[model samples]
Target: MLKRVFQALSGARPGEQLPVLLSFMALLCLLLSYYLVKPLRDSMFLSYYQASDLAYMAIVVTVSSLVVIKFFNHWVGRIPRYRLMSITYAVMMICKLLFLLILPISGRWGTVVFYLWASVYFTLVLSILWGVINTIFSARQAERSFGFVALGATLGNISGAKLSAWLAGSAFKDWALLLSIGAMSAALGLILLAVQIASRDPETARKQSGTAALHVSRGMQDIVSLFGNGYVRGIALMVFTLALISMAVQFQAYGQIDRNTAATVYGEEFAWFDPPGQHFEVIYGLKKLDAAAQQARLKALGRSGNLPTAQIQELSQSFGRYQKQFESRTRKVLSDVYAYQGLLGVFLLVVVARFLFRFVGLRYTVLILPAFYALAAMVLMFPLEIALIQVLLVIGGALNYSLNNATKELLYTPTSEAVRFQLKPLIEGPVMRLGDVTASLLQIGISTALALWLALTEMSQGRLLLALGLLFIAAWMLAIWATGRRYDQAQQADPPRQELDLHA
Candidate 1:
């Protein structure tokens, strides 16, 4: 049954089954660790900071990512592949252990540090894993097998998200970090075993030797030369534009959450009541009351100005209790969003991705995400209910994780080893973060301008953001077309091997 299922989903012959299965399991654990930590990281940060603060945090993360990836590239030649992977996992585990100890006492700063580290962690770890996989499989093998292997990641994401939500609501919440660490340890073991199995194949062994021999230059120079290639430039543009649009959408979603929550707790008129620097201060002075009392107080404040200090103090005490409830609610909502997103991803990877790859072809498959983004932009043109925003987030996230991700990884299959190890990390890590920084700066600027404009007119920031995102999507689509053309050219130049026989 297992063999038949593997063959049906992946087109893997008997000889190809073991390596694919091992690779699948390794990726499963890798993503399991990542998803487990993701909610915790977001919840912890948002507990003390506003949603807008993430833009600045993204800047710090981008800078840190550059340093981390540069160091990683330097060691690509010095360390053996499997051993290097193991060491990276070990270091991450140790950092998680430190976070476990430090988070409790270090306050908001600790959360900031973890957030930055987690961003870098996911980028670096994913690049390394895919780099290893690219080394193991021939281009033909990767085309058919990558989707099936990626299924493990989808399952792991679902399991991790569900597990994190359960833990957050249960008495075992404290154990979540430890479990994430254990998941990475398991992944490290599986990765080492997979590398060992692939090394036994003579063709794979020869490929690995050739890859190792090509790593003669300093990693920095190789990265510089990679930009000279038009295909690489196209990929970087696509990645950057995707990151920019994603961050903009995320900021809008978070803003909606904040606005909705404030409306519920404060009053309906307070729904659009976004004060520049006085968000918490305003919340502190306003008591949670019925519509009549809230409206009465709003009128009173408008006429009489500031409340008495004693009254403000009393209301702030009440707001503190409300803040705890707010934090708990925020965590639960984020957990649900991530869980549903992962579930959708699982469905797409299992049912949609393979068919698209088989029938749609690479050029068109690359167009799907931008097309979806265009639809999402249309949705943002109207006032969005919280539930609708959550749906958008889940669907958008699902598409990226499933169809988009599988397609992107396959693009790397035809590249050389130096490109895979050195240049790929730089593109995926720092270049991606550079997109986030650009988005942040844009958000900050637009928001500052809008805060003044909103006083006179009733325009939403989402519409403006959508307009900007549509432009980015256009560029993204063009990049995909160019990159797809290059990829097709590469594949034609050195065609894939014949499909393996099932009975062999």
Candidate 2:
């Protein structure tokens, strides 16, 4: 029964199941560890920096990724695979612990460093982890097992997001402790992964014995060599385009989060729930009133009775003066709510991805991902209620975890192992980060151009964001088409060993 289930899930034979399971667990722990602190990272960055500055921060991440990857290459050659993996895990834990200490004392500067560190850790750690997986399995084994192993990442995302949300809601909401928990989880997972690698594949230890260090100079050469290859360039472009849309969607979600927090902050001071003339006397009055119930409260507050201009002005001034104390609580609640909803979306990805991969080929199923972004952008481009905006963001995020992540990994299978080892890091790291930088610059440029037009001609930022989203989505679609075509050609030229019949 276990063999049958493993066959259905990963197309792996009974002999391969243990290694696949180990790979899955390793990824699950790694992603969960990162995501545990992810919400806090988002909140911190937005709190300290403007939304527009995200692009600039992404550029920093790009540079940091390059540096780390170079460092990774150097170490991979000198250390045993298991020992290096252990060291990698230890370094990540130390960084997380340091972040816990710094977050309390260093203020915004800590946030800035945390943001950069998290980006580097996320990029480098995942790259190294995947590289390890590739090293352990033959290309044929990877083709069969990677899809199932990749599911662990999705599961990890859900587990971590849910854990973080729960912590956020709890009274003893010490972020420092939460981060410590995540770091520890990562360490435990990595240690187990090391044991599994050492025990199962002693040959890997032999391969690592005397490999030369990957020099920093060679990193740039690897990147340049990739762009020079048409096939690799196509893969890079696909990643680049997808990254643009993903980052843009994230930016908008952050925008929504910021807007929600701002509303919560000033909801007491401003008549946000009702028309300008009709105001709730207290926060409870606003909080308790459902749409239908609000009418009765408005009437009780003398909605029909015209207040003098001076009284209205005084009421507005008095509002939020005492209520400022509660703003932290409100923001925390809002952030947690969104975080929970995001967790739900990730959970949904687990279900949706299984169905897609089962029924549709990897090549075709991923095409659906860009459609999700397109539809989301089209719907959200116009004026939308906050509730609807949150819903759309959830849907987009679900699609991201479901199709985007899995499909991207599968694309690597048709390529040579050298490409898988060297070029993939370049693609996933710098090229992907380059896309983010492009998106960020574009976002800033479009917003600035629109703002100037708005001063002269009354265009809204919402419509501008939507327009930019559509533009990027179009590019994303083209990229999907191009990459899909190229991938099909590549597969036909060099088919996967033990390839499952898509029709079956």
The TM-scores, one per candidate, come to 0.86, 0.74
Shift in Å, residue 367, candidate 2:
1.9
lDDT of 2 by residue, 1-504 (tens): 867977887666656677778777777777777777666676656654556578789888888877776676565546665567667777778777777777867856787898888776776667667766755564445556666777777667666666666665576455733564565466456545644654455444433332333433344676676777655666687778667777876676666566456555555445433445333334334433333454444344443446565544454444434233233443354445445544654554445555554455555765786787778777766667767767776666655654576666666554544455566777778878887877777777666775676652222555565567677667666666665555554445544332212111
Give the worst 10-residue stretch by lDDT in candidate 2: 495-504
Give the per-residue Cα lDDT of candidate 1 at 255: 65
Task: Spell out the clash pairs found in candidate 2.
Answer: none
lDDT of each: 0.75, 0.61
Top candidate (lDDT) = 1
Best by TM-score: 1
Question: What ranges in model 1 sit over 4 Å off?
Answer: 209-223, 261-281, 284-321, 449-460, 492-494, 497-504
For 1-504, candidate 1 gives per-residue lDDT tens digits of: 978987987766667778888888988898889888988887777666677888998899999998998888778878865677778878999999999899878866687888899989888988888888888887667777888888788778878888888877777887878999999888878877887888787767655655534474474685676567777777777788889888988888886675565445544223233334245445633433433564556455544545575654444444455555555556667777877887898788878877776666778888888898889888878877779988999998888877788888877776777777888888999999998998888777667776576642323655776688899889889978878766655555544422211111
